[model samples]
Target: MSLTQEQKDAFKAIFIETVTNFAQQVGQATEKVFLQILPLTVVAGTEYLKSYEEDLKTKLEDCKTKSQKIIGALSTVKEPEKVEKTGDKHLPLGELLGKRVQRGEDWKWDDQDGGIGSFGKVVGVKGNGWVKVQWESSRNENRYRWGVDKAYDVKVVEIVDDLGDIPPLEEQIKKPTSWVIGKSVVRGRDWKWKDQDGGEGQIGEVIDVCDEGWVEVKWKNGTVCQYRWGGENAFDLKVVPKPKE
Candidate 1:
């Protein structure tokens, strides 16, 4: 079967064209299949991711609910009752009522001086965590009240069976007396001037004694002002006995 050179060339050209056409047809078919499956693949992947996200969301919600339940349980659980230590013994808050307490025994509130070293008997206990104390210095109608925590924390008061007896209201509070004008006096303890010029231990003269326990004083620095005698000023004035002329 020997063929001429021209015939051999024609056969080679036809074989090359047929192979190229077959490769082009195969490539087009593969491209068509990929285009048809791409949308479905994307949709399936999206659905899978959505399901995973929803599962994670559900888990997070469950965790949150469980945390809330745990917190609620902790909040509802009653705390163990604590026994407060006083001196050598431990006592509860209920036993503190009717106890005798002294002022300045321990730190209470900043403004409260623990009754200023005076004794007090617990008269009543309030549900709002306050104990009513009848101070020895206070009148019958007047009572000092303190928080339950402070009453327990401060070693000022102790449980006492006997408080002796309460004095009459009239005896507790002294009667008002007239102040002699031009009387020399020294500023008492914790005395502060309104203008902050003079203070405790400063010398002054009583110019007048007004109603409502207010006393007008002319200080050595020539500052004249009125102050509440036994109130916030707490001015303890010691009268200087006038020397014989």
Candidate 2:
């Protein structure tokens, strides 16, 4: 199921919060370790406890990796400007979103050669020139990353999106294209639920729980559903279409 914007935003927010908290906790834990009085001892003691610590570190690394993935997935637009420009000053998001996005193309106009440079497929494109074309970075890899090089300036040219790498706007967002609902209730931070059908259910994890009567959920099965949060838990039946494979 495609995720709703509310659900997506909530999820992104949680992941960001978790990553931030983990970093802080790790810093504090490291500081504590340094403050230890192991002046003349080995690096560790209680082999079992040492093993546990190792496992904890491994888990922490895994969480960090997952968090990184979340960041990479969610950060697609540039940070929002105070106001969207109506004219040629800048393109409103509606003009850019769902626009023809190619997978292996590039455009390099305003060049030293004084010509338009559009090449390959889009790979990815933001507004008119802001894009990530099918070009490889100095460091080549078979993986996608949240390119932070979109905020840069090049000589003889106006600007560049951090070397053709950019993240989504921290403010402006794409509307959700899909969702779900049914005779079950989801609640709490985890947004878990007990389906009245005598089955365990969850809206997935809580996306943004808005002050409004809406709670978004992106379920484990990759379904995004939102419910008006009020009254009784179970409401009319709502079904969601399976996402295209």
Q: Indicate the TM-score of model 2.
A: 0.20
Residues forming the 10-long window of minimal summed lDDT in candidate 2? 171-180
Lowest lDDT sum, 10 consecutive residues, model 1, at 171-180
TM-score of each: 0.26, 0.20
Q: Write the per-residue lDDT of candidate 2 for residues 1-245, one digit (tens) a residue.
A: 99999999999897556656765777755344444424323454566678999999999999999999999977774554524434322333222211222121122333322223322211222332343322222211111111223321111112222212322322111212111111122343223344522334332333333223454544556665554443243322222222323
lDDT of 1 by residue, 90-205 (tens): 23434555466654333445434334566655544444344445455642212333443343423345654322332333332242212223445565445554444376555665
Best by lDDT: 1
* Whole-structure CA lDDT of model 2: 0.36
| True lDDT of residue 88, candidate 1 | 28
Q: Residue 132 lDDT in model 2? A: 30
Error (Å) of candidate 2 at residue 103 is 17
User: How many angstroms is residue 104 displaced in model 1 relative to the true structure, after the best TM-score fit?
Assistant: 6.3
